[model samples]
Target: MTTVATSSPVSGARRQAAEGTLGGAPLGPAERAARGKAARARAPRRTHAEYEPAPNRADPIDVIDRQSRSRLPELVPLRYQRMTESPFRFYRGAAAIMAADLAGTPTSGIDVQLCGDAHLLNFRLLGSPERRLVFDINDFDETLPGPWEWDVKRFATSLAIAARANGFGPSQRREIVATAVSAYRTWMHRFATMTNLDVWYAHVDVDEVASRLADVLGGRGSRRLSRATSRARSRDRLRAFTKLTEVVGGERRFASDPPLLIPIDELHTGRERELLMGWLGSIVGRYSDTLSTDRRWLLAQYRLVDFARKVVGVGSVGTRCWVALLLGRDDGDPLLLQIKEAGTSVLADHLPGSEYGNQGERVVAGQRLIQASSDIFLGWQRVEGLDGQRRDFYVRQLQDWKGIADTERMNADDLTLFGRLCAATLARAHARSGDRIAIAAYLGASATFDQAVARFAEAYADQNEADHAALVEAVRTGRVSANEP
Candidate 1:
């Protein structure tokens, strides 16, 4: 583990902020950093390494079941089955379980709008509004203002688990985790010294990422970089349309894939179809209102052609996700938008409830706050489900140059570079909502916090495997249902 040097002189503005000389200030950067460091008096950094559940800790299965209660019953088994495949997969889908465990861990008492589920897989490449590809935290359904350490811990634990999955030994896993934390600390230091606009514009462009990887790992790095870039470039709207839609009877409609992508007409017919389409039309109307005037006008040019119930993601399989296809000018001109269900964030249990009553709005707000650039069409709406329950949904373009990291195919060196990239991105996200100066100061010139978090990652990875085994046992004993892919 390496310590970040923060020996540079504090700026005059930071000095004023720290000394309470700044108008209407709660505290200065120095004061806050001092307070943050003093937090170790009550909660020693080493204490975070402990992951033993309290005697009365809720059963992981029961917590999962509670989350599934509001989900589509038939699709719930798929979530379980996906999670049951491996400890890494289980970790991805077990945000609720980790939330419980994180609640019992020590904290730095610093809060930030977190990705809440900042696992390694959640960080990916996407197109910015400028159509420039950038790497960022791409998942925000579980985002909320909560303990900053919680997100860091989740990210670190993910690296440990993923390293194990990639056949890296314990020493390599620990080093990878430490490197991630070190990168985060170093970036936070840089951000703390930057102007607000600079921090806002700060992002890891995909080209820069490719160059950095090539510099580090030579030929293997170049190959991975090329693969990711090519994949993202190939996933534009035109390609998605060609792959996910078909022309039938002179009309373009979503292709059917039972239990995953069922077209609206396939699911309803006659009077029911009429009512459903009418309801969907209203949903689109409401969603359009949430967008900016220009975007709304841009969307109005397209006419809705079809929609489908699309199952997506490991943790979000049971959620009500839909893809709507729209045609612009002609059959060849098309647009696709995904309306994904957004429930209360998992962090809600650990922090004060959000001011936004609608979970969709919560997700949208948090995403705009953390992501360097968001989809132009991103919006939110509340809609009534088939079960007569009201649900919140955030809408955006389905796949705009999206490229996800293939962790399963990565070796130890590949995972290391990937971890570094994600850690830096996470630091940027936290800087948007948290006191970066204070955080950087508290982490000053020492590897104490980094090593402690790495230890926690190792312990939590062990706990994750144990919980995964328990789920396996539950499936074996018929205590839970799981459907194999």
Candidate 2:
């Protein structure tokens, strides 16, 4: 790979071009934005629907590690933190697959959330402001654009991991994989033939979805399971949001948590809260542009209600995370947006792509490009933190009722239904960005991709085990620090 000196303005401009930023004369912000957007409208559009394998590429693992070395050191600690959550260090150590799959896949161009870590556990129903059950990918940390196949392979591999973790036999895992592959193939076919507007309007309401699944399953146990999952999801959101902000006559403030929520006593210097508020402004201006024409205006109307550094996600634990509560005409009329640091994409080190100036912005733009629909609040910016490094951040809503499957307790039948949904979601993402017709033709109405992934999963499983062992050694040798809570 060619290294460009980041210090030079010309090289920096070129680097920013890859990031979808344009430069021009010192025009007013409004004029510059209008001109840049018009240029984008007239720009040549190329879709990755037709893809072929690259020739004589370097080994993918080497490429991934090289890119990874340049990433923020905080990312390694974060990855380790999430991995330690389940003693399943293998799963934690091996986000490595995302790189390999991106490097290996045949092409189609897709633009969407990319899920960053697409797996069975990642997708769940989240409540919209209208209390409508809207389904969307809930994670954005590693979110970025690339070969959509990377998400698919990661999702499929995750299913395999969850199935094994849940104690399903290999045959059951294979059957689940087949179901998932089928769903993906079917969904891609459905999505490819869809009109752009139809694709944009797509969202699954959990109630209807549960009812539909109930119709298919048509049994007491299935009904009970569906109900239970729905309740868990709904309750999870409630648990996180109820204490989110205490709304007085018209102002919102977080309900108290002694140390967790940053006590009043902790504000002796008041610098932390000031830095947080500064970051919130960037979230609206930089992150929410991909929102629809109307929604962007509506978002701009809301005033900042409250913000605090809050802990979130397994992998994102301890990373600087903050939630900004936005109140509209009334205090009860609210919007909650989350601004969190964006780490390197799981595929970054592995895929053949230009280096990123800020991997977080890449994550933001990629998600907007690939997801059929995206959060109205999605945007990215860089902010200086106490550590002095300019942290790259992508911001979105917090506790939007986003839930994941209970992988720990799922049975074979549960895996079958859930894995298929995960697979179908992945394919929808890929179909949007990749040449679906060609991929469909390539998949050639067979389970070849499925088989290839399974073999890859098993092989990578060993690698994960080795990586996990290495992580264990790192902890023992004081290469990284942690405290068990």
lDDT of 1: 0.85
Residue 344 lDDT (model 2):
65
List model 1 lDDT by residue over 23-139, tens digit each.
Answer: 556675567677667767767766767777779988888888899998989999999999899999999989988987899888876667788999999999999989899999999
Model 1: residues with Cα > 4 Å off, grouped in runs:
1-23, 26-28
- Which residue pairs come into collision in candidate 1? 17-28, 18-28
RMSD per candidate (Å) reads 6.6, 10.4
Please give each candidate's TM-score.
Answer: 0.93, 0.72
Per-residue lDDT tens digits for candidate 2, residues 295-408, read 668877888766666656554555566677677877556777777777666655654343457756666565654454565566566767655777778777676556555677
